[model samples]
Target: MTKINVETLTYTQLAKVFDHAILKPEQTTKDVEQGCKLAIKYDAKSVCVKPCDVKQAADILKGSSVLVGTVISFPHGNSPTTAKVAEALQAVEDGAIELDVVINIGHLKSGLYDECQKELEAIIKTCKAKRSDVIFKIIFENAYLSKDEIVQACKIAEAAGAEFVKTSTGFASSGATYDDIELMRASVSDHIQVKASGGIKSLDQVITFLQKGATRCGSSSTDKILEEFKQKNSA
Candidate 1:
């Protein structure tokens, strides 16, 4: 049987798994600030904003324990490796401590595994060599991949030195599923973490993923999830 020890986790422990969202292009500076405030209030590990708002999010999160994160080749993973590398570097310069980069889904689908692996390796190398402390999560956009493909991608991600292998971009057809999370956990070694993102809206879903071995949850519903968790535990 699967056992969950939610009571053993402090509020901060639950909060640190969140990667708050700031993905919309229309999101203003005020929006980013508000998101940062929510992340801090909930003690989230990071606030994930669009690349343009990385600096603003980082500024708002300053002095707080929250780390700033941003997406690269977001929503779509078709950008060249060089462009993604440049974007990741710029985000780091803008004070981002974590990067969630979308892997080239098309290449993976076409069986260009070498190219896909090389793309991730390039980004990992750049991030580690330039900013050793920064964390890199490779988003496989799992909704588009098969079960075998997911396992293969996890292997590639682990071999390429990515810190995490994540699910969807939330713009895809589907989001994180239990099957996908389990597949990722079973495929990668303990050294690599797993992030279950996309379509997570409730505390139950958050706990479900964490219990299944996901180290992080990416969602815009961070505040709502945390509120539900507190309410449930308090009652």
Candidate 2:
């Protein structure tokens, strides 16, 4: 991964690194609307919303540079492979160009590598069938796994043809850490990207992760972080 030079970074370049999240269970439709507007205003790379909000986000973001993204089997990866496949297809059909699916954490922790890989393949295949360009990101929920398991999850995601491997679901016990990001970057080939999510609330944190090798970050603190960047860069 190329190093990110903080001194030369632009607001547009940094904003594009964020997948602004609005996935909280209790957030209302009004919140989704407002969130989408904020994302559009910032020209964020995408707005990651709850599965149910995909269509609404898509509608509001249509024709804008921001793309619609949604999560499947989110927060928990306990759903069956068939169910996950159906969810992915629905999300894509609803105008979600990106899908972030949680891996079956239990399966990986129990040494069920084949099961995990098969599930990822099935969902990826189903989504690609609907739209060939749908981006697939496999979320590891790294807080639940050991360091070795995190490495294993990275390999599994790469093998399953996922475009990115993510750190958490943002509801986990913890989120992305510097060590985990470096380890994930080292585990995968250069073509595969890493995304750091959860608990990131400042520009300094975002820049640190980008320099460590993350291509994207999931955060709800988009306005705060970006405003802080403006204050720093404008001085």
lDDT of 1 by residue, 1-235 (tens): 1465568777888898899988877888898989999898889999999999988887788899999999999988899999998998899899998999998989988999999899889987897788899898989998789998899889888888888999989998899998899989999998899999999998888888988889899999999988988887899
Of candidate 2, the 10-residue stretch with the lowest lDDT total is: 1-10
Every candidate's lDDT: 0.89, 0.93
Candidate 1 local distance difference test against the native: 0.89
TM-scores for every predicted model: 0.96, 0.98
Most accurate candidate by TM-score: 2
What TM-score should be assigned to candidate 1?
Answer: 0.96
Candidate 2 local lDDT, 1-235, one digit each (tens): 5567667798899999989999999999999999999999988999999999999999999999998999999988999998899988999989999999999999999999988998999999877987999999999999999999999999999999899999999898899998999999999999999999999999889999998999999999998999998888888
Candidate 2 residue pairs that clash: none
Off by over 4 Å in 2: none
Q: 4 in model 2: Cα distance from truth in Å?
A: 1.9
Report backbone clashes per prediction.
Answer: 0, 0
Task: Report the error of model 1 at residue 114, Å.
Answer: 1.0
